[model samples]
Target: MIVVALRARSSWHKPAWWATAFGAIAVATYGILWATPVVLDGMLGGRNLLTLVRDAAAVAAVWFFHNAVAAQQRKPEKKLPAWGLGLAVLSFTVPFLLISRPGPTSSAFVLDRLDQFPVWLFSSIYIFIVGALAARAIALLSSEKTVMTRFYVLGLSLMLVGSIIELMYLAATHFGPTNPDFRESLYYVAERPFFGGIFITVLGFLWVYAVRVFWKHLARWTLRIDARHEGGEYLARSLATSSENGWSDRQLAVNSAVNIRDRLKIGTQALSRREHALFSGVEHLLSNHLERTPR
Candidate 1:
């Protein structure tokens, strides 16, 4: 979390920080709803309000995560329409208004008495959110070579799996009564996997933050360049490779010279030393190139 805050100084990490913040808020809201004992007309108002807030915040978290990662892509990323966002928020009300009573109900009643429409609506929104997160994570995993990007992918993947489990369990509670044995077993085992997923997600975020904060400094200190006697092109290529592989500094110094040596191993091929020096002085080409890289 501290790392996220620190990284927020850069434009690239701002959205990521916001995503985390919103996620935290959603979690807190859920905790409040579960623990509080306030009674509001014994029905739809308080519980529904809390649920809506949680859902809205969750949606914002996913949207921000997608936005941050997508900004790094070369091509524009797919976006949810504004109306689509509104619809997602609206779905939270369906369960409160139709499927669920203001107070708690028995598992049997929830399954047999309530309609499945609201349950499916709730599940679909969660699936869509997690699906979007998974897709973005996959894209980043495939394209970005950085180790930290993998951690980001891992975190999103964990959340996706966890969400699916929770959704399935919820569905089962509603429908599992059709088979009494299945319902009982599912009730016992359903929540365990969900927490495991949450644990992994937290760990993954820690790994991602570590890379974001320390990887650059570590690379800068550990990298050993042997281009001391090499030609300008050789040095440039080496630095370019390092930068592409996330082994170079965000800000680098580049220098070229007038009387630079342009000899090959054979000490042959003469070229304009000034031009070579100019190119050499330019910072690692990869640094320049990365301006366009979604990383």
Candidate 2:
């Protein structure tokens, strides 16, 4: 996230900035988890409201990630209006708040409240939003044939699959027997894909960034070599075409030829065989011109 934030400093309007925002929200979502139920329950008055906040942050992160992909592909960034997102939050929050969640918050709030319809509604809503966005991202990324896009698609596909598994788990928990061991096992199974997806997606983005940095440096180096080649050729031609007649003119031509030679020598490795032959011909021309010049 820090790396993306620094990259965003200059390109705040670009896709990288959107990616940085996504990273921040993702970190916050996990940070909520890392804080643990005990700390969050204490902080939020024991209602597990932090779980709602975490889900909301996760949704926002997915939205930003979708925007980043869209921007990278030069597609229109289709945003759910602020009101719509708020409504989505309210849909789950109102029901979750209305439900009676007695005692201190559990580490697995959803699993603990699996008997409640409100919990089901909350989990369903979250899964639907994430799944819908992941599906959209997959569709968007599929059109592009680049390696970067492929990785993005693969990561999103994994996430979409994870969301599907969560949906299944939600249904099973709501309808089937609430065996703690089975529920916990299935929950972890649903979670694995999300972790895998996050890892793969981050890796893909890093790979693309590294490749871009390499190519950018290579381009600059190539430009410098080309500049040297052009400078050498220009100076050589000018010296060979000189019509001035004096010892000073001869001396000046000698100096210019020497400068051109130095440039050619510096960029010798970058020069092609044809370019080498061309410079050799120019050197011969300079020698002839020097011999003809009046002392």
Clashing pairs in 1: 72-294, 254-281, 255-281, 256-277, 256-281, 257-277
**Candidate 2 local lDDT, 1-295, one digit each (tens):** 6666677766676655665565565555444646755775567787777677767766766776777777666677464345766776677777777677544666688888888888888888888788888898888787789877888888888888988989989999898877889888889999899768867887887787776665444333333443464665654454344434422343443554455456555654445676456545544555754332111
Candidate 2: Cα lDDT at 170: 92
Residue ranges of candidate 2 with Cα displaced over 4 Å: 4-8, 12-16, 29-37, 77-84, 209-295
- Give the worst 10-residue stretch by lDDT in candidate 1: 253-262
> Which candidate gets the maximum TM-score versus the true structure?
2
> What digit string (tens of lDDT, one per residue) describes model 1 on residues 1-295?
3444565667434666777777776766534554542332124344344555566777776766676566546344554445766666676655545655534422233334334667556655655565566666566566786776666666666666666765676665665554656655664464454445445655665565565555454333222222444545765675687567754343322111211222322344333466334334332343443221111
| Candidate 1 clash figure, as a count | 6
Colliding pairs, model 2: none
| Window of ten residues with lowest summed lDDT in model 2 | 241-250
RMSD for each of the candidates: 11.2, 13.3
Q: Count the backbone clashes (under 3 Å) in each candidate.
A: 6, 0
* Residue 28, model 1: Cα distance from true site in angstroms: 1.4
